[model samples]
Target: MSETSAGRAPEDAAGPAAPAGPPGAPAATLPYEAIRAIPVRHYGRWAAAVVVVALLGALAYGFSQGKIIWNTVGTKLFDHTVVTGVWHTVLISVCAMAMGLVLGVLFAVMRLSKNPVTGAVAWAYIWFFRGTPVYVQLLMWFNLSLIFQTINLMPFYKNDTVAVMTPFVAALLGLGLNEGAYMAEIVRAGIQSVDPGQTEAAHALGMTGAKTMRRIVLPQAMRVIIPPTGNEFINMLKTSSLVSVVQYSELLRATSDIGISSNAIMEMYFVASVWYLVLTSVFSVGQFYLERRFARGSQRSLPQTPWQKVRTNLTTLRRPKVAR
Candidate 1:
C-alpha cells in the first residue's frame, strides 16, 4: 500500500488506488437515478399520466359548462343503478361460469363417450344451444313457466307444493346453458391439447381412466382452458343484457326503465355506456392477468407483462406483420 508523503512515500505512488472510497461510503452515497430507473416506455406509467391529464381536462370542462350535467348524470347513476348493476352483473357472471363449467365438463366427456346414445345427446345439446340465439333462448326460458304451469322440484322449491320458475331462474338457465355449449368445445380442445403420452403413461402407472383425467389431463389442460374461460365470463356479463327482454331487472333493463320513465333516452343510454365501459375495462385488465397466469404451461413461453404486451403491440403496429 502506498501512502501520502507527510514523512513517507510520495502521494503519486497511491494515484491509481487513492480515488477508491471504502465500500460503505459508495453504498451510503446511493445515486437516486440508478436506484429509480423506470423505463420511459412503461405502459402503466404512460397510461397513468394520460388518464390523469384527461380526467383533469374533463373536470375543468365540466365545471366550465355551469350546468354540471356530467356530474348530475354521474350522481344519478351512482345513487341508483351503478352499484346494484355491478353486483347483479357479478352474480350472474359467477353463477353462469359455475354452471357452464359443470355442463362443459360433462358435455366434453359425453362427446368422447363410447356410448352412441350419450354422444348423440351431447351433440344435440351443442347443436341446439349453439344454433339458437341466446336472446331467443332467454325468451323461451322466461315463457317456460307458461308451459309448465307448476314445477314439482320435490323440495327445493316445494314451498307451495307447486312452484313456478321465476324470471331470474330462467335467465340463469338461459345464460348458463347457452354458455356451456361454447365452453364444452373449449374444454374438449383444452383436454386434447395435452400429450396423448401423458394418458398412456398414467395408465401404465396403474391409474384408472378417471384418475388419469382428474390428475394428469385436467391439470395440464387448465393452461389452455383458463384464458378462453375468462373471455367467456366477460362476454357473459355483456350478453346478460339480453335478459332484459324477460324483464329480469339487470343493468340493461334498469337503464331502459330509467330512460323511459325519466324521458332521457339519449342521456340514459350514455349513462349505460359509462357503466358498460367501466365493467369492460375492469374485466379486460383482470382477464389480461389471468391469461398471463395460465400461459405458464402453454407450448409457447410465459406471456409478456402488460408493458411488454403494449410494446410488442406498438412494434407490430409499426411493422404490420400478418399474424399466423
Candidate 2:
C-alpha cells in the first residue's frame, strides 16, 4: 500500500496498527533509584551507651561519698581474695564434672540394664536426687557429720572428736552427687539417640556388648552428650554459688567476704558478676564451637562464621524500633 509516487501514508503503517492492546502483557518496568537505595538505620543505638554512662556516674557519685577507696573494691579485686575464689570456682567445676561423669555412666548403665534390680536402684537414686533441691542436699551434707557422729576415712586418721566434714568436702559431695543424677539422664538420652542398627551391626561383627558400647555407641553418643555436657558445666559453675552457705571459699563466697570486709555490697557483687561473666563467656564460646562440631555430622552445610553471625546480629539491631 505504498503511495503511488504521492505523499500518502503506507497502508500497513496507517493508524499505528491498532495500538498494542490491553490483553497483551505489560512491558517490564525498570527498578526506580529510590527503591534500589538501601534503607538507613536511625541513631537510636545510644541505649546501651546511656546505661553505661549512668552506671559510671553512679559509681563516681558514690565514690564521692567517701565509702569507696583503696581499702574497698580496689584492694578486693587486686588482692588474693578474688584470685582464690576464681581458682576455687574452677576447681569445683572440674571436680564435680569429673565425679558426675563417673556416676553418670554408672547410673546410665544401671538405668539401661536388663536386670530389674539394677534399673530400680538407678531409678530410685535418680528420683531422690533429682526430686530434692540441691541447696537442701548441701544443707544435709553440712550436717551429715552430726548424723554420723564420728566418720571414718582411714584407720590412722580416724578422729577421736566428732568428725565434722569441712565445707569444701560437703560442697563437693553435694554438687557432685546432685550433678550425677541429672548427668545420668543426659547420658541415657545420648545413648538412646544412637541408631539401633549401629549396635546390631557391631554385634553382628562379633564384638562383645561392652566393647561395642565403649567403642561405637559411646562415640556417637558423645556427639549428643557433649553439647549438653558443656551447658551443664556452665550451669554447674553458677550453681557453685549455692556452696557459699556451707562456707566454701569459692568465688561467690570470696565476694561475700569482700563485701563484709569493705562494707561495699554493690561493688563486691559487681566484682562477682564480672568474674562470672568472664567464665560464662569462656564456657559459652566453647559450647558454641562444640555444638557446631556436633551439628556438622548431620548438617548439610558449614556453620556460619563468627563474622557472619555478627553481621546478622547487627542487621537485627539496625531494624527500626517498634512497640511490642
| Per-model TM against the reference | 0.71, 0.73
lDDT (Cα, tens digit) per residue for candidate 1, span 98-137: 9999999989979988899999999999999999999889
* Segments of candidate 1 deviating more than 4 angstroms: 1-71, 153-163, 297-301, 307-324
Local distance difference test, candidate 2: 0.84
Name the weakest run of 10 consecutive residues (lDDT summed) in model 1.
27-36
List CA RMSD, all candidates. Answer: 11.9, 9.3
Best by lDDT: 2
Q: What are the per-residue Cα lDDT tens digits for candidate 2 across 178-233? A: 99999999999999999999999999999998999899999889888998899899
| Runs with alpha carbons beyond 4 Å of true place in candidate 2 | 1-75, 152-164, 305-308, 311-324
Q: Residue 41 CA error for candidate 2 (Å)?
A: 8.8
